[model samples]
Target: MNVAEVMTTRVVCVDMDDRLTIVKDILDKAPFRHLLVTEDKQLQGIISDRDLLRCLSPFIGTRC
Candidate 1:
């Protein structure tokens, strides 16, 4: 299936300047495993659940 077929259109996204707390809340409450970071309604990059977890590592703490 194409991404548009399975991907969530009502995506929970975060702006570039949004705080981590907001992103964390969306990650915790949303069903999706990845979030699309956007600016001016344009896609920037994707932040996956694993990426957030990796940020917890001491070696890469806050890397995300």
Candidate 2:
């Protein structure tokens, strides 16, 4: 088996400046684990669920 055969063709991407809330939402709603960060249609970096969880505040979505 090859990478292309196992990899997803329908990619979900986010902007470089997108907030953690947006990233969290996307990841939460999607079945996939990775999100591509793009700038002006160019790939900037990749973010995973683990990355979002680490960067997001623990108090997020909580009422204090």
Candidate 3:
């Protein structure tokens, strides 16, 4: 089956200048594991749950 068939259309995205607090809220509310990062209405990159967790490592736990 094509991924588009099941992929979410209402994606949560954030601007490069967006605060981490807002991004965290979206991540907590969004059901999907990925967020499309955009700038000036253009796609920049994809941020997944893994990326968010990695960012939290500095404050939460260190990776070995």
Clashes in predicted model 1:
0
> Compared with the true structure, what per-residue lDDT tens digits does model 2 show for residues 1-64?
8998998988999999989889889888998999999999999999988787666666555686
For candidate 1, lDDT tens digit of each residue in 1-64? Answer: 7888876677677888887667778889987788889999999998877777776665565554
- Candidate 1, RMSD to the unseen true structure: 4.3
Query: Candidates' lDDT values, in order?
Result: 0.79, 0.88, 0.81
Q: Report the lDDT tens digits of candidate 3 across residue range 1-64.
A: 9999987898788888887777788888877778888999999998877787878775545555
Which rank order by lDDT, best down to worst? 2, 3, 1
List the candidate 2 regions with Cα displacement exceeding 4 Å.
57-64
Counted clashes in each candidate structure: 0, 0, 0
Q: Which candidate leads the pack in TM-score?
A: 2
**What's the TM for model 2?**
0.81
Candidate 1 C-alpha error for residue 44, in Å:
0.7
Candidate 3 lDDT score relative to the true structure: 0.81
Q: Which candidate is the best by lDDT?
A: 2
lDDT of 3 at 27: 81
